[model samples]
Target: MSTFPDYYALLGVSKTATTDEIRQAYKKESLRTHPDRLTKATVEERKVATEKFQAVADAYYVLSDPSRRSEYDILYRTKAGNKSSDPGSSQNFFSQFANMFAGASTGAGTGAGPHGAMPGHQPDANGVFADVFEELLRPEVERVVPWWSYLGAACGAGLGFIIANIPGVMVGAYAGNRLGAIRDAKGKSVAVVFLSLGGSQKAAILRALALKVLGSAGM
Candidate 1:
């Protein structure tokens, strides 16, 4: 008998959920179940996390596509319809689809759910990389902070550099001590060294700081 997976329940979203809501839930769930997050876990734990991650990815791939989602809904309703009727029927629509899917995969199913395989023949070696790339490219509303916040930090760093460069102070001591202070408080220092020179050198420092902030935020 063919089995119809509950795509909505698997995604932890209601049947009536909006597209954006489904996408958000999928991102949150996938990140939580991602295998990379369980590096220190036991073997069994890693196995389970992989399965769960694939399931969430499968759910998102279907629900995010308008045509596939409509087709899935139809199958979902038909299965529901079957359950409410007599159980003596010789065959069901889903069972046929399931059989066809098995034949297509030639019994070596992708770990993704029955319907979740990408279109065409994807070489196994590249599947995981493709999935990660797609996830990163998907736009979402969540961000650690606005772009302007990083800009402000860069500005603050520049202003501090100017104030520390008063004519009487030795440039090396001022830059080294300021860097040490940053290191002591944060337990790490920015990799790029900033010089106290008041011209293009200062511009380079500010640019480095801005890039550092953006990198820290995973932009």
Candidate 2:
């Protein structure tokens, strides 16, 4: 029952594609979804593309590493299936836990990142973040937010922060405005601003594109 991904499809390459082919595919896709180059599009549009782009980044990040790629391949093949466990084997629960936790922080799982858990834990979290970015880019998914929701989270009021994080970059501006008043046509409601990297249009758009591509994939 293990779920598996057609890694070749993820990279837009055939299964017979060479290592260089994979690398080239990744590079081409990366440039296509670069966020900084998305000035013409709305913030939401850029975010979706970014999420798709991140998927590619993560896939390439793993596929490029031999050991990790092997592990990923094994995991993908058996992720939805089960096998007999070896009691006498050295691999144990602790080791498996360590593998899952890896670079993730303790608090990260309690309620961190997009998953309400740590990285590499729930595929859903990946999907959620990826969904946000994907929606941002798609012309059909223009789910814009009010100006207050983004900026008002800092207030003592019991408002929720709906702005999405773009990995290591600054928060967007939609999350920067004051928390109050009715929505205005001229209000700051751009999706890219919530990530705070809107000023650096080129870099932000590239990231958004990368992430969007990443989320479009299935594993």
- Top candidate, metric lDDT: 1
Cα lDDT tens digits for candidate 2, 20-115: 666667665655655555667798887876655555555444454454456656655654443322211112222343264345443321223443
Model 2 earns a TM-score of 0.38
Which ranges in model 2 have alpha carbons more than 4 Å from their true place?
1-6, 79-219
lDDT of 2: 0.43
lDDT of 2 at 140: 19
TM-score of each: 0.43, 0.38
What's the residue-level lDDT of 44 in candidate 1?
86
